[model samples]
Target: MKTKSLLLAALFAALTAIGGFIKIPIPYVPFTLQIAAVYLAGCLLGPKLGMLSQLVYVLVGLAGAPVFAEGGGPSYVLQPTFGYLIGFAAGAYVNGWLMQIFQFRKAATVFLANLSALFAVYLFGCSWLYIAMKWIVEKPLTIGQTLWFGFLLPVPGDLLLCAVCSILVARMLPRIHSVIRKQEVVS
Candidate 1:
């Protein structure tokens, strides 16, 4: 990877951490702008770098940085919300991969890509929530309850954020691509 790409990845990792700090506390999942940052990182950086950015954020948190919505550490894996953190990296990779394949120029395509990415996030997040609650935390919630808490409740806000991100990406992506091209040439 280019130095510029590495720098951008680090920048997005910081942004994701910042997003975790700015959150509205709720029952199980706190609503945060981390998802938006993740999406933007994917849209701007493409697949490998986008995934690298989120992985950096996750690793930093695991290394005992308080960069997560709750606190952070190795033990954070036991938390119900930890799955969502993993989902961030997965979602970014999916979004970046889709964008690369589709060459998302239209707003609709961008929005679709965002939605697909969102699905990946929910898949990991909801699954983790279910497993953590049932086995790790020993709460044993029903699937319906897990879906309600993990998916349904936070999804509306997440959808709105994704929509906004899609619009932003649609407008800004061309410029970002050109800048990246220039960076590659200079490198």
Candidate 2:
């Protein structure tokens, strides 16, 4: 069970790196499936493993793996978008926690879990963006501007992704859980 969990976590981390490469560029931030991969990791692997997966992703990128959307290095931490990268782990953790709490059984619960995960990501991303812009970039932004640039602009797309993630989680969790259970029995 431990080995399986670690293997799956590594796989999800790799998938996240791959997801970053497929992006739609815009001014504020690039739209990528990376968050979706994070969502799937949590919903599929549960909180601990999912979070572990994201951590691996971050660690690798920070170590200069070039796995992130732009590029990767220790200095990447100074970038405004680094907040979203960190948020991915937090969001996955939240997603996994909600999935476990709701037992990943109901459509509404699945939707709520994904939505909450998205909120977690947004919260972290926005807060970090605000701080980084002020301290790192030396360009302070008002709360209204932060919301407009960091939160509001991306919301509709994020919400749509959350909805799609919810549906996918609903459809996949049962089978995935069943396999995990069977594997646990074998172990």
* Per-model lDDT: 0.91, 0.86
TM-score, each model?
A: 0.95, 0.92
Q: Which ranges in model 1 have alpha carbons more than 4 Å from their true place?
A: 180-187
- Model 1: per-residue Cα lDDT over 73-187, one tens digit each: 9999999999999999999999999999989977778888888878989999999999999999898889999999899999988999999999999999788779879999999
Q: In candidate 2, what residue range of length 10 has the lowest lDDT sum?
A: 24-33
Query: Highest lDDT, which number?
Result: 1
Q: What are the clashing pairs of model 1?
A: none
Tens digits of per-residue lDDT for model 2 on 12-125? 999999989988776556777888888888888889899999999999999999999999999999988888888889989999998888687666778788888788888888
Error of 1 at 21 (Å): 1.1
